[model samples]
Target chain A: MNISGKNSISGMLKTILQICFWGGIAFLILLPILLFAIGKHLNSFVYVLYPNGICFLIFVKQFIELFNLLKENNPFCNSTVKRLSIAGKAAGIISIILGAETIFNIIVIKDEITSIFILGFMCILFLGVSIALYILSELFKQAKEYKEENDLTV
Target chain B: MGIIVNLDVMLAKRKMSSQELAEKVGITPTNLSILKTNKAKAIRFSTLEKICEILECKPGDILDYIE
Candidate 1:
């Protein structure tokens, strides 16, 4: 009964993430078609969207797993650690893609210097998040070991 | 494997059921099972004291060391 509110909130978050995951998939599928409908050419700028979309989906997946762990009241288990690690890798991949995209944009579009700077900043920011998540995953792993030892102590 | 619990041997010598000992020790049957099966990571001093008191044995009687 005490955890009912927490479970409800986790359920709500899972639902939202599920919606985002599917919506992102649909958007990725429709993006090129919509661009073509507007008579716009698909360029290197458009190529970057594919990896970004995939990274967003991966993040949704990571959050869904996290919400499931919260719902089960086992947020410090091995699965949670694995999910965090996966999310960290996903963010790292996204950061790499953003770095490449920034370089491509700088060469292809000379007038978008400010936008390119913002993209480079995002790359650095995501790299930091990835490292932080990796460290947090290691901490969770130690916590899980401690919890198991405590559970068995009695 | 340095510390081994001889809980099963003690239980058998005392002619007591695991459920009975569990109830007396105020621990769940599952936890007693963990101890008996040597699946527990560590034993608490309080639990060791309770088991010793209930079984009328020293901690040494219920634990052994192996090389």
Candidate 2:
């Protein structure tokens, strides 16, 4: 199977990611309006989702851009490195926001312990993912440099 | 990067054009331009050998080291 090209794996993945991202965007836009129609208020949990969801969307958008590069058969380019770093930073921001929300839940709102534990767990998970993405971005940056050097070697 | 390719000098000495050299060496004109413009990071030994053989010159005649 081809790694990159018009009909390659990366192209399929890019299409899938585009579907999910647009679907999620639609969901993000419609959910609050639907809830408001039923006269629902902005609960703490729901409010937290807005900020974190935006960050998550940005992360997915970066991945979509990276996959676009792969589909173009130029995965080892500067844009891929930039997109990966942006995605990593988005993940890191999500971790920090979740951590702050968890703290707020414990101190101000006094949410249930199980809920707090769940939020804390998610915070740690995102932190781990953020670190891993950052490492991957660095690896890709080095790979791009090596690829440029190799391409110039004639 | 400090290693400069004086391919143009050797080509001129042989009274050959870049396009002809590119074809004779089995490489693209774009690659030849890259080498001539010093944008290439490195060159393969085989390509160097081919260039030397075609130009009938030594590698040193085409490559120079500048501080």
Compare the candidates by lDDT and give the number of the best one. 2
TM-score of each: 0.92, 0.88
Error of 1 at A107 (Å): 4.7
Please give, for residues B1-67, the per-residue lDDT of candidate 1 as tens digits: 6888899899999999999999999999999999988888888899999999999999999999998
lDDT tens digits, residue span A37-154, model 2: 9999878788888888899999999988776676567888878878888998999999999999999999998988999999999999999999999899899999989989988988
lDDT of each: 0.88, 0.89
Candidate 2 global lDDT: 0.89
Candidate 1, residue A111: how far the Cα is off, in Å: 4.9
Docking class of 2: medium
Best by DockQ: 1
Fnat for model 1 comes to: 0.83
Candidate 2 chain A minimal-lDDT segment of 10 residues: A3-12
DockQ of 1: 0.83
- The number of the candidate with the highest TM-score is 1
lDDT of 1 by residue, A68-114 (tens): 67877778888999999999998999899998888877886764678
